[model samples]
Target: AQTVTQSQPEMSVQEAETVTLSCTYDTSESDYYLFWYKQPPSRQMILVIRQEAYKQQNATENRFSVNFQKAAKSFSLKISDSQLGDAAMYFCAYTDSGGYQKVTFGIGTKLQVIP
Candidate 1:
């Protein structure tokens, strides 16, 4: 079974600074996908970024980027130029290439943007 691990239970950052959240996973499958989802106070799960296990390059979107280490089965999210609106609960998820695939999420890391 694939399981995502988020060692950090909570993190805080200044409104205009950058913060990186750590995430690690254990999977036996060679091919799979990793994702980072953000759930704001509205309780909506928004996709932040995604990375394929076969791909060597990391993925980035605007102020968000990922450090994907396939060999170590580690995937982390970095938020640059953090803003007050960025405060939310970030979750790391994993899915494998199989029928009726289900996403497994970590406990989550609560990010607090300090003004």
Candidate 2:
């Protein structure tokens, strides 16, 4: 079985600052996919970024990027130039490479943007 772990239960950052959320996983499969999802107060799951295990390059989107260490099975999300809207629960998720399937999510880290 595979599992995702987010060490920090809560994180806070000032607007325009940068923050990194830690995430580590345990998996035996060689091929899989990793994802970071954001859920605001609205409770809607939104895909923030994704990384393919087979790819060596880290994935990034706008101000969000990932530090993917395949050998260590660690994937962390870095948020640069943070904004107030970035305040939410960030969840690390994983899915098998077989096909479109359900994802396993971590407990999540709540991010607070301090004014």
Candidate 3:
């Protein structure tokens, strides 16, 4: 079993700037996967980034990167060059590769982009 927490309920960033969304999680499992998902008003969970617990290097996708502190049980999302389309609800999630693979999600953080 695991639990995820997003400290920020809502945040706003200026266009072309960067915003960091914080998240922390707790789990007893050693091997697992961490993820940041973005859900627009359309209500679809889109994967923004992912990290493998066994990997030492942080996961990155273009302007999106994850700062994963495995020992501290923290995973934060960094979105660079913020765009209007980036405004949405972001959720931190966890799922083990083995076992039942149940997904545990955070309450989510709403990011607003200022024009």
Candidate 4:
């Protein structure tokens, strides 16, 4: 069984500033994929960034980055140069390498960008 937890239910950031959203997961599988997804008011799930459990280096995508600690089972997202468009519902998710195709997601953290 795999589970993802986001302690902060809501967060706010200033324009052009940076904000971090925390997430932690528990899983028995050794190999897996961790991800941060963003859902805006449009109701679309967008892939922000991803980290492979086997990789020690974290993953980054432009303004979006992740701090992945496999030992601690923590995967937090950092959004730099935050924009109004960055305001959305951020979800932390997990998927194992096994044949099972299920992806478990957290309750989500709503991010608000203030001008």
lDDT, candidates in the order shown? 0.95, 0.96, 0.96, 0.95
In model 3, what is the error at residue 16, expressed in angstroms? 0.3
CA RMSD (A), model 4: 0.7
Q: List the residue pairs that clash in candidate 2.
A: none
Error of 1 at 58 (Å): 0.4
- What tens-digit string does per-residue lDDT give for candidate 4 at 36-105? 9999999989988888999999899999899998889999999999999999999999998887768899
Single out the weakest 10-residue window by summed lDDT for candidate 4.
Answer: 94-103
Candidate 2 segments exceeding 4 Å error: none
Q: Once superposed on the true structure, which residue ranges of model 3 sit more than 4 Å away at CA?
A: none
Poorly placed runs, candidate 4 (over 4 Å): none
Write one digit per residue (lDDT tens) for candidate 1, span 1-115: 7889999999999998999999999988998999999999999999999998999999999999999998888899999999999999999999998858799999999999999
Error of 3 at 44 (Å): 1.0
Which of candidates 3 and 4 is the stronger one according to lDDT?
3
TM-score of 2: 0.97
lDDT of 4: 0.95
* Cα RMSD (angstroms) for every candidate in the order listed: 0.7, 0.8, 0.7, 0.7
Predict model 1's lDDT versus the native.
Answer: 0.95
**Per-residue CA lDDT of candidate 2, range 1-115, in tens?**
8899999999999999999999999988999999999999999989999999999999999999999999999999999999999999999999999766779999999999998
